[model samples]
Target chain A: MTPQSPYALALRQTGDVRDRADFLDQWRELLAEAVDRLLQSGVTGGTPCASPHGPKTDVDAQKTAVLILAALHGGSTLSQLAQDPRPLNAALDLALVSFVAAEDNTAARTGTSSSISKLDL
Target chain B: MTTVDSRSGRRLTARGEKTRAKIVAAAADLIYVQGVGATTLDDVLMASGVSKSQLYHHFAGKDELVRAVIDHVGERIIERERDALGHVSTIPGLRRWRDALVQNNALRHGAYGCALGSLASEVSDQDDAARRAVSQLFIEWQGLLAGVLRRLQDGGALPPEASIDQLATGLMGAVQGGYMLAQTARDVTPMATSIDMALAHIESLSTD
Candidate 1:
């Protein structure tokens, strides 16, 4: 991603004020859409776990979306630092674990799964 | 071991060491707030109140100074993390660590992001030495987390089949990612949630 990307700008704590605000809004929207799609995929079975900080409503998707995006941004930075992809993969896996189907999750926990492929992100 | 100037290759006297530390602390604060690219040596000189010759005596140039700042910041962060994560061997201990992180970030609403992570994003592509230093620090930080997970495994909190290294790496990612999200949102909710999710994943793997 470019240094101007939302994640980069956020990490560096730099960028124009207006641009930062716009990017934040755009990022939230994009992640929220992705979360909605994941939810619609029946992975969460239309009844995801309640978010600790959010009401027991559709807002859970929005919150979950933020968490996933955070994981990507954070994990990618670590990956870049270490020159290894394991950090990113593990972080993303944990971020989206709740969305995995039960059988897939069991398989994953057993080290014999491709549950990440199911999300198709 | 006596600390020597990286550029001059001369050991520092007590007074010289104090001056060098003053410069590094000033640079770290400036870099943390404004970023590496935006921070100029002139700003550091002004902030540190060091003469030009004194600054040059300690560092070869801005790049060297930045590297020093990276180490300074990294050490500070890692030391704090080690202290906090040292006693964590249970899920509740992990959550307490998470709460302290979130609470600390909330003080400034995460406007500053993480010190090492922010430095990594800014310098990883531009400065090879800085990148390596940051990479080393991350490895150390990850190792600390892995140690905690290993403790959990030894205590039967986690299953033998659990990959403690991967879990530790994921937790570190969650922390760094949470810091970025909080910085972006100017709120700690995202930070708290990101870390909580990672902890939840680890808890899911708990044998108890």
Candidate 2:
């Protein structure tokens, strides 16, 4: 069933072990990885927040991924609580807006398209 | 009408009322830290310094006492917060309410999740009565937010076509899910970020 289903969403917070296991299977590592990427980035995309010594990962592409990840779990919880899907829509909108804004800002500043701007999302 | 259970202490003497309140306060604290299933009746008795019979006299069983703890959480934590939500249509008011919630969790050192939401997670599926109580509390909260958003819509601060209930629900999810994320991350920033995103969503809906 889709995460938009009220039952699936509410269960994320208080569901049984199996239900939790299922949710984790789908989104757990993804969120962690995305969050890690966000933590490294300047988030504003101005300073290049990626550390100098850490393994070279694409912080730019991960920006959109992070927004998408945040929207999914955050959207699931909000949709369930409101008993409506509109919040999810708002969240997804916020995600895209965040990424696209970042992309534009980066491209304007550097006079070159940023990695996040290349993403199809 | 659903009968109000006597375990509510409505029929108690002054001294009995004091004892009942004491028990509930103790249970609320323990349950806040330990969770419902982990906290036993003995934990309440020991924590409150009440006798076994006194515990029973005050509550028919653990479930009754748990319901009371839920009420205590509602009164002590949520009601005060709800009053703040009444002004959520305005920008500054929403920030005040959001800051208070995040600060309260930070004060707990980010140990237990939201008192109500944590209790909710433990009992949402395990106990029907308790689950309904938690659900009602959330509804009250969501309603408070919806009330403000509806007012905003009417005032043309927000788009009339925007579904206020859905907006409120999504905001509540941000708060609730942020609590869980902050709890796991052992940092308050996640909660703050979630709330920030939600408020931004409202701004996106605003006509201004």
Candidate 3:
């Protein structure tokens, strides 16, 4: 996301949100929509676990989306601190591990330079 | 031993040291609650009960004082994590560490988020020095978590092929991300779910 994006601003916000409940609710909805789109793209790439075509897969994708969203929000903060992209990459890699094809997962686990490592998050 | 103030290039006596520590602690608390942008030197002075000259004597300006606050907060967090996760070697130990973190945030209803993380988010773009300080603390924090994962690997719990450092980094992301979401939602469910998902992933890799 761009630095000026609402998500980016929210990620960096440290103030109290007790008075902005409606704003937060809308932000969460927007984030969830974005996550759903990302998961749809991942599914189209033949990642079965994240496919939105089936009921069970839809639930799994929702769960995975939450993890991915968390990683993005959390990882981006760390990435800013270190001025390095590896933390974000590593975080996204792990969050998406469950949906990765079996062979790719093994490749990642064994440190064999999988596509997950190439993610430019 | 005489402690020297790095910014002022002055050696501090015991009383001077105590005064400096009090200022830093107060500033840290203010920054934690109101954020760096909203917090001012005057507020810090009021909260710390130190004169303007005394505050300046210890720090060059607000930026310098902020750096000091970063160090002070980082040290406190690292010390607490060391105590909590020092001997954690099994999945249950890791879960207990997670539980304590979640429970602590629940007390504030996830209002304040992680102390070091909230500071990192606020000052990272504006203050490069403070960013580096916070980055160092995160590295140390990640290292502590990696140590626990390494122990699990060595004990034949986690597979030998697993990368402890990456797993540790992922876990830290989950935590910080969880805290952010939890703070925004004013509920601990998001934080708990985020962390539990990361832990579950690790657990799925367990051989024992």
- Name the candidate that leads on lDDT: 3
Off by over 4 Å in 3: A1-10, A14-63, A101-103, A107-121
| Ranking, TM-score, top scorer first | 1, 3, 2
Pairs that collide in candidate 3 are none
Tens digit per residue, CA lDDT, model 1, B9-49: 88999999999999999999999998899999999999999
> Residue B191 error for model 3, in Å?
1.2
List of clashing residue pairs for candidate 2: none
Write down the lDDT that model 1 would get. 0.77
Summarize candidate 3's per-residue lDDT along B59-137 as a digit string, tens digits. 8899999998888888899999999999999999999999999999999988888999888788788988888889999
User: Tens digits of per-residue lDDT for model 1 on A16-106?
Assistant: 7557657766877887887777565544543444445332243357766766777777877877777666777777766666555354656
lDDT per model vs. reference: 0.77, 0.64, 0.78
Report i-RMS for every model: 2.5, 8.6, 2.4
Q: What value does the lDDT take at residue A58 in candidate 2?
A: 36
**What 10-residue stretch in candidate 2 chain B is worst by lDDT?**
B1-10
What TM-score fits each model?
A: 0.87, 0.70, 0.84
Q: For candidate 2, what is the DockQ-based docking class?
A: incorrect
Ranking by DockQ: 3, 1, 2
